[model samples]
Target: MSTLVSKVLVGSAMAVVSLFASIDINNASADELMTLNGIGKGKAEAIVAYRKNHCFKNANDLSSVKGIGSKIVEKNRKEITVGECKK
Candidate 1:
């Protein structure tokens, strides 16, 4: 491959990575939530379940979930959001 093509491929990959780096916990699916540090399938599902009864106003609200705590929230704060997800 040419140098330009290689650079374009690398740039595209980086863009995709950055796009998924921060996810909206309120709107994210279990898979998306799993992208956060220390969050697995069970915790992701818990987040979804908690959001069903209570909407998150901010990243800190994640602590209200059964398995989530302040430490988890703080650890993934930069990678989490409370924005509405685009359908």
Candidate 2:
């Protein structure tokens, strides 16, 4: 491939990566939650379940979930977003 084409592809990939790097806790599905740094199937499911009854106001609220903790929230800080949830 030509240099220009390669650069364009790389830029597009980076943009996509950055776009998904931040996840909205208020609306993320179980699979989306799994993309977090320390989140797994179980944790992701728990987050969804918890979200059903509670609206997380911030990334720190994730720690309140059964299997989640402050460490996980801290690690995924940059990846978590709080919006459209309860104030």
Candidate 3:
């Protein structure tokens, strides 16, 4: 039972690591963007549009948009990426 619990904990940690590592906004679709916390369809559209118009150089650029705030950024930080360089 102890071994099983250890395995479960390790697996959970790996899953979380992968989630943070794979948040490539360049390839994310509208539906995927919406999955981020505090993101709705409109905010998702703004994200995509911003990427198209100016190209994202870093995650901090997201805060420049009209509706995004620090709270939203913190909430969605794990599910978003910028400067992907291949949109």
TM-score of each: 0.78, 0.78, 0.64
* Global lDDT scores for all candidate models: 0.87, 0.88, 0.74
Candidate 1 structure quality by residue, lDDT tens digits, 1-87: 999999999999998987668888879989989988889999999988887778888898889888889999998888987896333
lDDT of 2 by residue, 28-49 (tens): 8898888888889999998888
Candidate 1 ranges with C-alpha deviation above 4 Å: 1-8, 85-87
Residue pairs clashing, model 1: none
TM-score of candidate 2 to 2 decimals: 0.78
Question: Any runs in candidate 3 off by more than 4 Å, and if so which?
Answer: 1-21
| True-vs-predicted CA distance for residue 46, candidate 1, Å | 0.5
Of candidate 3, the 10-residue stretch with the lowest lDDT total is: 18-27
Q: For model 1, state the Cα shift of residue 28 in Å.
A: 0.5
> Candidate 2, which ten residues in sequence have the lowest lDDT sum?
78-87
lDDT of residue 8 for candidate 2: 100
lDDT of 3 by residue, 7-52 (tens): 9999999988755654556667777777777879998888778777
For residue 29, model 1's alpha carbon misses the true position, in angstroms, by 0.7
Candidate 3 C-alpha error for residue 35, in Å: 0.5
